[model samples]
Target: MREIIVLSGKGGAGKTSVTAAFAALARDTVLCDLDVDAPDMHILLEPTGTRREPFVSGHLASIRAEACDGCGECAARCRFGAVTRTPDGRYAIVPGHCEGCKTCVVLCPRQAIDFTPRTCGWSAVSDTRFGPLVHARLDPGAENSGRLVALLRGKAKALAKARGLDMILCDGAPGIACPVVSSISGATLAVLVTEPTPSGSHDLTRVAKLCDHFRLPTAVIINKADLNPDEARRIEDFCADTGRPVLGRLPYSPDVVRAMTARLTLPEYGGPLAEAAAELWQAVVTLAAASRPQLQPL
Candidate 1:
């Protein structure tokens, strides 16, 4: 199956907006929102009939009050300050402060600390107006975001296969971090949505290099290209130098905000940006279907 991932070098680059438009336009596809830390696609797609399950990763330590002997050994051995003395002068493991290092669990003399699986977040399969959506929500301050992303992608792939779908469209997280790394691995194509600004240009370069590191084919779509003509040209020059395709440019329009406020995809709202999004989606499909070397994870 062909998998197209929409990403941005930084936040507020309109990546999710473009992805939602593609969702409205594409067919026979499974939609995936890989930005578990801050998922907002449901706001536009309005997913329903969700099937959710807890995401358990790593472990957290809690003091068993019954078995505790008020020994300060666990508190002294914890380097993260997760173990602290409560008001009753008894040592306790602070859930938020615990880093799951198992230091306290291993070092406790009384063996009062209980190490159990942590419910970091949850994953879901839901129905949207367009198609099936496999999304997730990571708890605030939770770790293992990359793992959650991979798990969600696996579910999307499986759902697509079961439904005899041919495509999987993913909305990836911003920045070249662990979650982005997980999102791009084994992707058929990476569509980068960027804006015309100094930070946008710089971050685009960083994320593009990250795609290159994995030997992934990439394309660029400059959002609000008219805002700064010079910076847009600079971005185009960079894309040319790097041998990445510039699919299309979307002009600045107030209707984009209006459509967002109405909780509608650009295409559903209908505007100049919607037309541009349609054209970009076509380019992405063509590129994704083109013959290329098999992608192997590094």
Candidate 2:
């Protein structure tokens, strides 16, 4: 099966919006929202009957009040100040402040600290009009986003295999971080959506270099090309210099915002933007085939 990942170097580059449009355009596809930390694809897709499961990361420390000696030992050992004396004179572990390092657990003289599997967040599978979507949410200030992204990708791939679909369309997180790495791993291609700004240009190069490091076939699409023609051309120049094709340039329009505000993809609204999306998707399909001639069917 061929997997296509939609990624961006920064947030608000319209990555998820483009992915939502692609979902509406693609046929026989399994969808995945890999932006676990701040996922919003479901807002447009409107998924239902999602099955949730705990995502266990590292262990969290909890003080067993009954076994505590009230010696202030745990509080003194915690570098994060997670251990604190309660109003009732009992030592307590603040769940958020605790880094789950277990240093206090090991240092406690009373053996009152308990280290248990921490529920970092949850992953879920839901059915949308397009197809089965594998998505996740990371708890506030939680860690291991890369691991959760990997899990979500696996679930999406499995669902694609089960449903006999030929493609997996993933909406990846912003930036070239661990989460993006996990999202792009073993993918057939990476579609980068970028805006026309100095910051966008800089981040595009950074993310492109990362894709190069992983030997991923990458392409670019400039959104809101009308806002800044110079930077848009600069983006094209960068793509040309790196030999990555500029798939399409979508014009700036209020229609996009109107469509989004109504919880719909541009393609579903049947406008100039939709036409551009169709052209972009067609180019993507052609390139994917050219990039991997013998790609297996799902």
Candidate 3:
């Protein structure tokens, strides 16, 4: 399957909306929302989750008071300084501060430390009007986003393969962080969605650098391209200079907001915005087909 990740170096660049539009156009594809921290694809796709499972990663350490001798060895050995004296004259492990290094468990004279599974979040498989949707939800203030992203991508790919699908449309998280790195890994193509603003241009360059580092084929889609024609020219020039293709440029339209209020894809909204989004989807399909392996069946 061809995995296409739509990403941006910053949030609110219309990346997810573009991904949803592409998903609406694909013939045989699975939609995956890899934005575990703030997944909104489900809102547009209206997916009904059929399966949900707890995702546990790493471990949280707790002290067994009954076994504690209060020798203060665990406190001294803990590098994270998670162990602290309690009002009852005992050392306690703070869940938020503990790094779960297991050093306290091993060095404690009384062997009072116990490691427990930490619930990071939940992953789900859902059925949407567009297609099979694989998405995840992260626990508030949870860590392990990179690992969760990998897991979500793997599930999406596996579902696509099982159903004999040809494409995996992923709405990747924003920024060049760990989650973004996981999103780009094994991607057949990376579509950088940007706007025509100074901040947009800056972040677009950052995302482009990340794609270059991974040697992934990349294309740029400029949303609100008319907002700043001068900046648009600069974006086009930058792409030309760097040998990256400008897939499509979409104009600023309030219809997109209306579509969002209706909880529908841009193409399904049926207006000037829908027409513009259709043109963008055509470009995307052309690129995806071009990037497909020659030996692979279309």
Model number with the top lDDT: 1
Distance (Å) between predicted and true CA of 60, model 1? 0.5
Candidate order, lDDT descending: 1, 2, 3
**Model 2 ranges with Cα > 4 A deviation:** 292-298
For each predicted model, how many residue pairs clash, with residues at least 3 apart or on different chains? 0, 0, 0
- Native-referenced Cα lDDT, model 3: 0.87
Ranking by TM-score: 1, 2, 3
Candidate 3 ranges with C-alpha deviation above 4 Å: 291-298
- The TM-score, computed over Cα atoms with residue i paired to residue i, of candidate 1 is 0.97
* Angstrom error at residue 85, model 1: 1.5
**Candidate 1 lDDT by residue in tens digits, 33-122:** 999999999999999999999999999999988788888988888889888888887888888999999988888888888999999999
Worst 10 residues of 1 by lDDT: 289-298
Candidate 1 wrongly placed segments (more than 4 Å) = 293-298
- lDDT value for model 2: 0.89
TM-scores, one per candidate: 0.97, 0.96, 0.93
The residue pairs that clash in candidate 2, if any, are none
lDDT of 2 by residue, 159-228 (tens): 8888899999999999988899888767899999999999889888888888777777888999998999
